[model samples]
Target: EDQVTQSPEALRLQEGESSSLNCSYTVSGLRGLFWYRQDPGKGPEFLFTLYSAGEEKEKERLKATLTKKESFLHITAPKPEDSATYLCAVQATTNAGKSTFGDGTTLTVKP
Candidate 1:
């Protein structure tokens, strides 16, 4: 079965605290890895897409990288507004258009 799991369901970090979020996954074969950020009442916003191991994408203080078995979202010096749920999803050849999403890692940044 293809599945994705995120660690530390919730995280509380003081402003400027840097941390890395983990997304572990299991799939028949990975076609793409997606990273998204969601706020309190909005749908997820695309952040990055990783198609292969060793590939990475970055924007502002956020960085996403993917591997054969897992992916990571790293937050550096985060701010209050940066607080949100970080979601990881994966699409396999057999699961095309059906991206399985992790429960999500909720991050709270305290200013």
Candidate 2:
């Protein structure tokens, strides 16, 4: 079975503070790992896709990294607008269209 776990269910950061969110997973065979940002009452927005260990992607103030067993979302000098729920998901080689998702980590960046 494929499984994902995100730490610090919720996070609070002051404007300009940088932090990293963790997503750990176990899968039969990794096909891909994904990261998303979701706002209240809205569907998640795609952030990054990583296909192999040591891979990484970046957008604006966010950076996503992948490892064999885990992934990280790094937020740099975040602003209030950066506050959102960050989700992690994984696709396994055995599951073509289905992905296992973590509950998500809600972030609050205050000015």
Candidate 3:
């Protein structure tokens, strides 16, 4: 079974405060890790695709890093507009099932 878990279901931060969220996973055969940002009532927007460990991707104030068993989303001095649900998904090599998503960590940046 491939499962993903995100920490701190909700986070509150000041406009310029930086923080990092964790995404942990357990799978029989790990194929890939995906990061996405989903705004209210909108579908998830792809952010990064990590194929192997020690790979990192960045865009603006957001950075994503992946490892063998987990991944991290580091927010650097986020603003109010950065507030949204950060989702993590994983594809397993063995099963042909759809990717499994984390419950998501909701971030709120106060201006």
Candidate 4:
């Protein structure tokens, strides 16, 4: 069975503070790693898709990188408005679009 675990569970950051959220996983064969951001009462918004080791993607203040067994989501100089729940999910080779997801790391940035 594939499983994903996100670290810190929750984080509090001051405006302009940079931090990284972790997503660790174990799978038989990795198909892809996905990252998303979700606000309360809303569905997750797509952030990145990592397909191979060392692959990375970025958007605004967020950057996501993938490795053989884990992924990281880095927040750079975050603002209060950047606060959200960051979700990590992984798809295995035999599961097609099916994915095992982490509970997510909730981030709060205070001004």
By lDDT, the candidates rank as 2, 4, 3, 1
Candidate 2's C-alpha runs over 4 A off are none
Q: lDDT score of model 3?
A: 0.93
What's the residue-level lDDT of 66 in candidate 1?
82
For lDDT, the strongest prediction is 2
- The pairs that clash in candidate 2 are none
Each candidate structure's TM-score, on Cα atoms with residue i matched to residue i, is: 0.96, 0.98, 0.95, 0.98
In the range 13-68, model 3's lDDT, one tens digit per residue, is 99999999999999787888999999999999999988888999999999999888
Candidate 4: lDDT of 60?
Answer: 96
Cα shift from native, residue 85, model 1 (Å) = 0.8
Mind giving the per-residue lDDT tens digits that candidate 2 earns over 4-85?
Answer: 9999899999999999999999999999999999999999999899999999899999999989999999999999999999
Compare candidates 1 and 3 on lDDT and give the better one: 3
Pick the winner on TM-score between candidates 2 and 4: 2
C-alpha RMSD for every candidate: 0.8, 0.5, 1.0, 0.6
Superior candidate under lDDT, 2 versus 4? 2
Instruction: Summarize candidate 4's per-residue lDDT along 1-111 as a digit string, tens digits.
Output: 999999989999999999999999998899999999999999999889999999989999999999998999999999998999999999999988798999999999999
Question: Residue by residue across 4-108, what tens digits does model 1's lDDT show?
Answer: 999989999999999999999998888998999999899999999899999989999999888888898999999999999999999998969899999999999
Ranking by TM-score: 2, 4, 1, 3
Number of the predicted model whose TM-score against the real structure is largest: 2
Instruction: Tell me how far the alpha carbon of residue 65 in candidate 4 is from the true structure, in angstroms, after superposition.
Output: 0.7
